[model samples]
Target: MRFGMALPGPNVAAVDCLPLDVLPLILEHLTDRRDLHTCAQLSKAFHNAATPLLYRTLDVRVTMYTGMQRAIVLHPSTTILQRPEYAKYVRHVRENGAVGFHRPDLMDDCRKALKMCVNLEGFTWSDDSAEGTDEGDFMRYLDILQTLPLRELVIQTFYGLSDSVWAKLQDFSGLTKVSIWCMEGKPRILQGWSEKLGASLTHLELGVSSLSRAPHPLYFLSHLPRLRALRLKGAPSAAILEILTFLPQLETLDTEYFGAALTRYDDVPAANLRHLTVRTSSVHIQGFQQLWPWIRRLTPRPSLESFTLNAFSTQGEALVPRSFILDMAATHKDTLKRFKADSTQMTLKDIECMCTVFPNLESLSCTTMWSPESAPYEEAVQKANKLRELRLNLHDWRPTHVRLAGLNNANIEVAVRNMMLREGAALRLVGIGSIVYRGQWIYKKAEDGSDKVEFEITSNVIKDVWD
Candidate 1:
């Protein structure tokens, strides 16, 4: 009826004003970005209230450089460096380079960004380009990064960094998570990097393209007392063992290569480790045997939660046996949740053996040699009542036509019925011919009414029938 007034109430003027507590409730519905942005433009009060939510997260992807640059220009008065809450709000910054921002520009931008993020917690940078020779640029970048309030830092680059980078990294007193990707050379960088990181580091990831013949690089990791999770690529076995000794609190260990030698964990203490994964181009039977002693010796035995063994062989056969995996499953049956093995030569029998040992397993997947007869598929299915998922594959199958000696309708019918009866129950899904195989297909007769059967067989069925 009137501006800012109520039509009927004890006191119209007083009733027009709602309690301040009610404003927050009303504002709750406007919390979305689009709605908040619209509300901010409506009034100064709304703008002041919404600014914090709008400016809390500052994402600067390599391609989003223009957006960040524009924000800097628009909010020149908003000094991120001066705000104590700046670190709390700026949780992550991803610098994946497609912006053509080279080392010089990246270093400059990093310096400015770090200074403002006093409470900065995590930083990630990626420079896939293969450039930069001197360590000076990297050293400067690390130095600036160390001064920031960083708890996590990830560096993905094509350049190989020297040991000096670790020395510069020591400045980050609060750093807890680190991921480094070196495109070239073995991670000889770990030789000095581990020592500088000391006992304070909690999570470490190193990706290297090569592994050196020498063992000194791993010795540096022996001092990390608080280390919990470790991931390495192309690291030697000796170094891995050395690193394991120091990580008494370690819970997760992932390695890209099984290494030249099998891991020997006899002397190492039982750690809090629960997850172990190893991916390698090849694995010797002797190596798995060598690892057995350590595997059986964990004192405060970790309930192995996840295990992955990836072996690649040029010989067209996976050398590792099902018994080896079964031993692992039996050793940690109570805690094992997921198990996966991929190789060209392993058989379904091996997988079935593994399944029996890990009765409580939730996920089981493998790509190996599949011989259905040898696997006892029926028995495995019965025993694996707890299994939630299963993935299996046959070693090989190629199309070939067969001409029956007793070519008659009765003979064809008997053969087809027998094949379907033997395999239909076991296979809920089958892949037969290339494209048609992906989708279910029924056998069809030719226009002349001749019996011309064509169908693709899945790797699983191939294993079963062959076995």
Candidate 2:
């Protein structure tokens, strides 16, 4: 007798059944590499949707090595080399010169794989090896990279670049962003880059162990008419802003915040500057004293959107003077949205004043000492109804009288949650007492069209929010 064949089950394509175009758009939002890896195994469609996202940024940098280990693990570039198609998905590659030391053949693999990355747009090269470790001709990799469609270049090395490598970099005309940090002697790498890549270079960062005594480290940078963001280390704040007089299109500046006041400020022009970060130490008192006047001289009122003053002191705690806050509020109150001052002290009254004065303040971070039950804390949050994020460093705030009673994590969470419920409907993040919680307000439209809001708060590790 003839046996009947088993019937086919219902066809179900799972979530991967979405159109090829729509599926990629959804998969691209997956930030966790583990999730993307799992999705890549679901089906050919899912693999196609997630492969590019997974391989988009190839980080083959060797972070660590131990003598106890056997042979070094093969670099990811080896896989890209074997599977030529995966090379096409690598749009950015971060490599440390140490990768070659881990295995002599790794550099060859990286060079071959990089060539296959015809669409590569960004490249980050770092060398963390000991001083005498052979650099193994950076020119080899640069030669292949120059042929690609690279647009962003970042180099942080302990040793200086050879003249040939620097010249090869000058030939890279399509670069839109360049960051070079050399821990060696004074680096004069920006000599002629302005004439070559200035039209496309919008973001530039330069750091060096030593700086020349010239009026400005790189005078040629003034020719970069389209420069929009400039970050400099080992450069005086006064000298950094002097270039701003020439960079009319510059919108953001990050630099060491110490220097003498500008010798000639009367001719200073109004800049489009929006975000400024001064990462420095309080040891430079004279420089700090001159900083306020320099900021005030920016001409005209309020255009800065974010200001971060990260000042640390080796002698004792540094404090941001209320006068400085008052000056900032007077000039930038209307536009300042994010303000961060770390390691420096801000009192409860200062925090309260910031909230009350800066109507548009969205993110505020500072080290402050305030009793959770104090009126200043209450007033600060009440006025900070519009603040979207609040981060406070209160490690120094644990007073002998209230440390056992009120400084515990449980109590702090309860007190902060109450503050959020009472005010700060717009608040989404609260960080204090070495703890971070992320919350969101869920709103419903009322019958009268007024909004009714509900909220949810959950504890989160620091990296989850502010990595």
The candidate that wins on lDDT is 2
**Shift of residue 24 alpha carbon in model 1, Å:** 18
RMSD in Å for candidate 2, one decimal?
6.7
**On residues 389-423, what C-alpha lDDT tens digit does candidate 1 reach at each position?**
55554454532222111222243233323333344
Please list the C-alpha lDDT of all candidates, in the order they appear.
Answer: 0.54, 0.72
Q: Give me the candidate number with maximum TM-score.
A: 2
